[model samples]
Target: MVRWQVNLTVLWLGQFLVMGGMTMIVPFLPLYLQELGMKDPHEVATWAGLIFAGNFVTSFLFQPIWGGLADRYGRKVMLLRSGFGMAIVMTLMGFAGNAWQLLILRMVNGTISGYAPAAVALMSTNTPKEKMGFAMGTLQSGAVAGTILGPFIGGLLAEWIGYRYIFYITGILLFAASVLTLLLVKEKFNVKEASAKPKISVIQAFGQLRHVRQLPSLYGVTLLIQFAMLSTMPLMPLFVAELHGQTAGLAFFAGLVGSITGFSNMFASPILGKLSDRIGPERILGICLAGAAVLFIPQAFVHNVWQLFAARFGLGIFMGGLLPTVNALIRKYTPEGMESRSYSFNTSALSLGNMLGPVVGGAISGYFNIREIFILSTILLFINSLWVYKTLLVRKTSIEVNFEDERPR
Candidate 1:
């Protein structure tokens, strides 16, 4: 147990270092574009949307491919590949001379950035069943902490040096993280001969949908929960800009707000995971989802910058528990030999939600007001939560029977 804990901790640290380095570029990318001669706010906004969207688009598209390869080739190799690949691309991004150059690099970075998912697959494979929730939660908290710190560090670095220097620094940190992973992580590829064959196609990886009848309640709840969780993501920076402006200081403030929210999640995740273990993950998820919806609605009404900040911070507390609980619930349903494939589908679903959230939010904000975007997001989340309550929690018996039959009975 101690050895496994140590290994998991080291893996968690590696994930933290990588995430911290990678996220540093996010807060400064728009500012970097403006400096590169795209001076129009609309263009900057469009490019920013593209930059954010590009990562998810590629990451979402390629996740199952990477997951299948990891299952066959080995997760440790994939981890190394992700870390080194990202380091190389990120370093090259510092040399980008034009907006198109930077955009291209971002797209490449997105295509190759699978370190988090790799680490997730590794940790999930190694950890014992009873402690899976705790282990996954702890790992997620590390990521949340890194996400929180990245912007603060990047903002300061961008101010002191330049946005280009921020990229260089991130690249260096990522390279260092890769080195750490190579030195510490020991791979024990547990592939059975029967399962090693190419039975699962990349398309079938997304075909967890076909098994909806197998675990209808769990699947439905998970989809709704993810949708509710991601609905507010795109509106965040826009909200910050409305309260502040497009200045570097405002950008830093926006980053700070984002970081603080993520930082709060760092503390809240493990506690929520433990609570889920004691009570029930579904119940905890229901509470958190509803709380996040209620908390987020008030952001639309916040009159001042401080009020907006407070609302986001409060929202973070409820939202923090979401990812770990979702992962735990998914783990509950995953069969023993298919952990990698199950996680791939799970992450793909999350990526799908992420892809839709920003596009929808951006369109709504463009068409109406930013505040109206929040209102729309809030209403959608509320409806999603209510749907989960009706469909899943209300039909517990049917779910139990399905689970019983799916097991080797």
Candidate 2:
């Protein structure tokens, strides 16, 4: 097997483990809080948001710094840093005596979160650019598959084995991921380049990206997509109940609505990725954004559980391509040697969206209702489609194409 192929395999499993381990706590976060002695539903809800938001706050701050370090040293080092750091944090969360302790531990976990971005940077640079869409798409499928499975397993284990032990199991999974990445993933770092290049400051790294054509717009789309997709998450169960109207197995149906997207996304990513390689990621991104916008509207008008599920599934098919398409575009336009820094900055954008989306969604849902959140998401995605068309797809005949055009290079 080729070296890049081996790296792709390890990174796939690595992504799967890290994502799965990270999400394993999702199903029972409220239960864990109960274990920490919060009986008030309001207090538990408040603490849940706090614990989750704190991590993203630190992660958004540190991603660029880690990205710069990845470029100076190697992306593989960043992967190990993230994998081991998360393993330690996951292990420590199991021992927290209070909600504050767990929240603080989550804050600390954010400081060292780089494994997935590191893997992307390494894979983007190592794999031939010609096949980058397929590679990134395949990598995305692993993470999507993990997301689909993690919550199910977490819920089951929380019932059978308990939440604390689930933390230990998640820690073990992450540690195994670190071990796999360390043993199987090889980096072709140039000793001369490492020694010769001066250390780059985080501010300097941001400046480097600003100069790349289409990169700034692509980064903007990262935030847009994440925010649009996640905005409805906090209200999903309530929406399900609202639709099902006191039906039996409400939680089960809600869980299916929540996760159905990942299943379709996992199946669609590689296929759309190959299509992107031929038609250009910019085109695929535009089409998907428009399709997602249209699909999200039906979700707002759904009269039955099946209608909701069908909408989410169709939405997922489009969601599958948006990020992979952006990643491919980012890889194509990013200047050589700046791949890690660029991807890291993009990851930071994603973290910001993850933090902001729920807040905005919660606010909108509070002000209006759960259904309005879908309309808001639909509007955001529609605006994003227009942005893609203007920034990435329009013809530019007068000036040199530079990084703007994805025409056969």
Candidate 3:
């Protein structure tokens, strides 16, 4: 096999393992806190939210620093740093005696976690630009597949083996992925050139991106897309209960609602990615954003669990298009030698969205109801679609045309 193809193959599995490991125990955090001796229901809820949010907060603050280091040192090194660091921290979480210890450990895990962005930077830098969309799409499918399966498997294991053991298994999975990356992923790093490049701080690096047309807007689109998609996730079970009208098999049906979207997204990502390669990521992004916005309205109106399932599945098909296309566009617009930093900033935007989405969704649900959150998400996505069209598609600069010509026919 060719080198970039080989890199993609290995890193796809690496992303799978990393994402799967990270998410496998996430759904059971409240249960785990209970096991850790948090007796009060309110206390468990508060600690669970803190433990979960801690990682993203640290990750958002630290992503740019790692991105700068990835540019100077090498993306593979950064990938290994995150994989190994997360493995160690995650294993330590298994040993925590209290909620406080788990919260701190989760924060540390976030601070060290950059595997996904590092993998993207490495793939983008190594793969042929023409195939970038496909590469990114394929990589995304791996993560989505992992996300879809992780919680289900964790739930089963929680019934059989237990929670703390799942953490150990997660650690092992991360360590194995890092070892595989170390052994199989080959990076063609230009040491002297990297050394000769002048160093810049995180703020200055972002300032550099401002000079690159459409990159900043693309980052905003990344945030908006994530925010829109995830905003409804935390409320899904309650929505399912309202639709199903009972607790019987409620968990199973709710899991189905959640996993259905990811299944469609996993299947659709590569197809849309290839389409982006042909037409242009900017166009695919706009269409998908509009489609997702439209799909959200139906979700708000769904009268049954099956209807909600169908809505989420349809929404997932469009969700598949958003981020991979955004990543492709970012690569298209960024100057060489700054790709790692650029992707890192995009990842930070993603982390911010992950943090904000659930909080805003919860607040909206509290103030009004669950259905209104979907309506609000619809509005946000609609506005985001218009923003993307005005900022990116409408301009159609000569540089984008040139980039399109470079794609495989």
Against the true structure, what is each candidate's TM-score?
0.84, 0.95, 0.96
Tens-digit lDDT track of model 2 for 67-177: 888888899999999999999999999999999999999999999998988998999889887788888899999998888899899999999988899989999999999
lDDT of 3: 0.90
By TM-score, the best candidate is 3
- Measured by C-alpha RMSD in angstroms, how accurate is candidate 3? 2.9
Regions of model 1 farther than 4 Å from truth: 34-44, 192-195, 212-255, 303-306, 390-409
Off by over 4 Å in 2: 395-409
Among all candidates shown, the one with the greatest lDDT: 3
Residues 130-178, candidate 1: write the lDDT tens digits. 7777777788888888877886788789899999988888888888888
| Winner of 1 and 2 under TM-score | 2
Task: For candidate 3, list the clashing residue pairs, or say none.
Answer: none
Candidate order (lDDT):
3, 2, 1
Q: Is candidate 1 or candidate 3 better by lDDT?
A: 3
* lDDT computed for candidate 1: 0.73
lDDT of 3 by residue, 155-257 (tens): 8888898899999999999999999999999998896899799999999999989887689889988898888878777888888999998868998898899
Model 3 alpha-carbon drift over 4 Å, by segment: 397-409
**What is the lDDT, from 0 to 100, of the residue 377 in candidate 1?**
58
